[model samples]
Target: MNTTYRKVIDRITAQTLALTEKNREKLSACLERFEWAKNDLLLREGQVCKYIWFVDQGMIRLFYNKRGKDLTEHFAYEGGIFLSLESFFRQIPSRLIIEALEPTVVYGLGYEKLHGLMETEPEIEHFYCKILENCLILSQQKADACRFETAGERYHRLLQEHPEVVKRAPLIHIASHLGMSPETLSRVRAGLL
Candidate 1:
């Protein structure tokens, strides 16, 4: 693995638990590097998600089409992780589509290899559980925001929390993620600016 990739892997365990060099090396061995150019589709609807992807650089989006409209569900920036959770956990075809919104580099660990490692690696298991917990928390927060926040408030919250998304993602995706149309988002941005 490259130095940058090793650093990302090392930091995961370093933050919460100490693992032996051998174990860390074993963990590192399971990951594969992947790169995507801008506008690339990393995963399409109906494909089974085979990897848990960690962003080493750049951005990715998770979205699905609803009634012929593209609705962005989430964005993953540098140091973030994303996958089609339903498909990944259940090992089934996903309705969610994963796309690269920028030139992206990510480290992916295969599901089977990851689960095998989790069986023997306590630290990896802990990390796995943490990822799951974060996913659930994020989902709940988005649901709550939709219920409680106005479109402008949602835009502001997103700007505060993930400024990179506002700066780097396409305006259309941002508008959809905030549960508003592009024109509404434009007005919101204009009013705020």
Candidate 2:
């Protein structure tokens, strides 16, 4: 396995579940790597997501179009994992689209293969559970932020926590993700919001 890929797996496992070398090797076997160019579409609307993609470098975004406007839902950069959760679990087409925001390299673990391993490998099962728990927590935090924080507060929190996203994502997308208009984001960026 590539060191970058292995390191990502290790990072995800950090303090959550420890894997034996043999188990780690088995996990690594499930990861296949691919490089995507800037602006490449990793997952399209109506495509069932089959892999959990872990970025080794660069950035990706999950978004959907509504009334012909793009609504950014999430962004993940290096060392981050992303998937269309419902689509991956339910084997249904996703309403969201995923795209590479920069020249990107990712390792994808097939949903079916991983689930199969989970059935037999207790550690893998535990690891999968940990991942889901983390994802749920993060999802709730985002929902809470949207429900309770002002746009400026939300933007500032994002800047403080994931500056990479603010620095790299398009202003329009950032604004959309924060549930505000681009002009609003501009004012917030200027400290006027």
- Tell me, by TM-score, which candidate is best: 2
Return the clash pairs for model 2, or none. Answer: none
Q: Tell me model 2's lDDT, rounded to 2 decimals.
A: 0.88
Give TM-scores for every candidate, taking all chains together and pairing residue i with residue i. Answer: 0.92, 0.95
How far is 39's C-alpha from truth in model 2 (Å)? 0.8
CA RMSD for every model?
A: 2.0, 1.4
10 residues in a row with least lDDT, candidate 2: 7-16
RMSD of 1: 2.0
**Residue lDDT tens for model 1, 1-193:** 5666567777656544566777777778888889999999999999999998888889999999999999999999888878899999999999999999999999998899989998988877877887777787898999999999998999999999999999999999999999998999999999853
Q: Each candidate's lDDT (Cα)?
A: 0.88, 0.88
